[model samples]
Target: MAKISIPTRTLNDGYQMPWLGLGTWPLQGRQLTDSILAAIELGYRLIDTASRYGNEDAVGAAIRESGLPREDFFVTTKLAGRDQGKPYVREGFSASLERLGLDYVDLYLIHWPLPLLGRYVESYVEMVALQQEGLIRSVGVSNFLDDHIAAIVAATGVQPAVDQIQVSPTHAQVDVVEAVSRGGTVVQAWRPLERNGGILEHPTVTGIADRLGVAPSQVVLRWLIERDITTTPHSSNPDRQRLNADIFEFSLEPADVAAITALDVGAPVKQDPKTWEEF
Candidate 1:
């Protein structure tokens, strides 16, 4: 959170989302609440959470604690895999809203396609209906592949406002990103720094960081920003939060970006969407 305003990319639905955000996952109870409160104090307006993460309540508490007008922040949450079917989608979203204590989320994402469940397209349909009802400002999907996007569009004739995917210097998913962007879907990288991955030790990124006199994380995020990609990087440390948000001031050169892309060896995925289930 720098003094300068964070830039935003308008969605296909005409809603605006900050280019950077704070991701809350596996963060719970008092720790999670405080982390969010600190992030808010640091000037972060975009906060990402999900029903599957089991911390929407904590997220809600932190937002209220900040004492800022609800309209002052942009909140994004996801529908869990367990709630993807027609039978549960509506009630599931209502439950999430209750937990968050918010009238409507800025963006509501289908957490994963879970093709094996055969409910993703219908789930998107349900989300569209929710949008029509004014319960969500924008609708989106996370961890959705190309076919998932096409199927949803066929069913609803609407591309999601944002496609939240895993992107890092070592696993850029260039082809998928190109396709998503071509269709006016904003690509938001979930783990831009590739936390818990070797990206922290990667020479190319570090080399750029050493030259730029910035943190390695800034190098990675700046590369994403340079390519017009947005990211929600999670950090509990107040100092790290500020550093992550401070990336807007510097940029990576074309060669640096290319070199970083070269590290894309199809880095190991945390889960295979085709075969994995979020529930």
Candidate 2:
């Protein structure tokens, strides 16, 4: 496997995380473990998973099998929606840690706001305690908008280290990115290529890819990186994994970035943060 350097973005909490990482959602069993092991072999250090994903154990097992020090890996997991309350934060985080077989996670996130239930702020209080106890290096939220961010900060003085959200050429949430930036929270783009991936075929992205002699997906990933939004792109194939990380080496011209950024139609997100239930 060819290796390349993946850059890091320091969080508000002073923790450095790889700007590019392996997104391990809906991937489990030997396949998940193998993919993680393959990623590690390829110089990929960040592994993203969630309690809702139900594969923390596999992620844990893969890290141990890799024969690398636990600190060598940047592991992230979320608090399940079912576990989104003050009463559940401690236990839920403990369960996830036990499953991941690690003493501390590099980052811990509240999977969703679940606004109607109105417990995220309260739950985050407990998460703060968990961090104080040295269980997590950083605490943040996902699928959160400005309002959700404001609430968390108003209730707790600490800001989130990163806000993970759905972002792509077609569904660029530029406003959300700017909104969170005000609080010193870094934005991490999850699913930078929308699930369907039709955006990769668009003339703008393809043209840039063709001119640069790179894959269309690489153009898109680089565009997001240029915007300073870290990406967690998932690929099960080792070749694809290698190709994804290849973005770091090449430069995307200013005009090329603008053309790709123009592709944002403010497309609707896959799940509405206001109403989607992840429990």
Candidate 3:
């Protein structure tokens, strides 16, 4: 295995966030605990989890048992769909903290816009309050569209430190990324492998990997890094996890980057933020 030097992105809020992280979704029980421990052992400092994942307790347990200082890790948890109002923002964060067995998280995010509920602005206001009180180091949102982000900033006069969204070659989310960038908010790509879209096998990506003598996944991840977008690709296999984090060793040429960019079809495999209402 190659030696990996993880890079950090300085947020507008004056805090540093790791560019690569371990995403814990659809993981539970021993699988969750073991993967987290393995990731930490492999030098993964950022662990992304959420209340909806139903694994915060397991995540907390693994962190406590790791014998690592809390400050060494960047822990991020989200407020669930059910917890999307001004009234529940603090309550939701408190529950997440208690479950994670932590005094404070490095980042807290609204899981979704929940636009129908029409309270995300209010919820974000409370997140700002929590940040002021030292409960969270940064505040952000997941699956938020450009309009949603603009609304939050317009209302509170504070831009989010990050915007976690589903992005890949197939779903570039160019508009959203540019919009978030205008506010100096870093865009974090989830499902960066495009879930089951077979992005790794796409000729454009694999061709680049072949020329560069790296795995197809490495090629894709490197492209995102070159674009200055943070990505967290989830995998339970320890080897795969290490491979995902080992992207620092190679660089994709400008032509290869352009080829991958041309692969974007402007569609998302998951729920659209405009209509997604999962609780």
Deviation from native of the Cα of residue 157 in model 1, angstroms: 1.2
Residues 38-99 of candidate 1: C-alpha lDDT, one tens digit per residue = 88888889999999899999999999999999998999999998998988999999999999
Stretches of candidate 3 exceeding 4 Å from the true structure:
1-3, 268-270
Weakest 10 consecutive residues of candidate 1 by summed lDDT: 1-10
Clashing pairs in 1: none
- Candidate 1, which segments miss by more than 4 Å at Cα? 1-4, 267-270
TM-score per model over all chains: 0.96, 0.97, 0.96
lDDT of 2 by residue, 84-173 (tens): 888888999999999999999999999988998889999888888899999999999999888999998988898999888888888777
Indicate the residue-level lDDT of 169 in model 2: 88
For every candidate structure, what is the RMSD over all alpha carbons to the true structure, in angstroms? 1.4, 1.1, 1.4
Q: Pick the candidate with the highest TM-score.
A: 2
Candidates by TM-score, descending order: 2, 1, 3
Model 3: pairs clashing at backbone N, Cα or C within 3 Å = none
Question: Weakest 10 consecutive residues, lDDT, candidate 2?
Answer: 191-200
**lDDT (10s digit) by residue, model 3, range 128-152:** 9999999999999888888899999
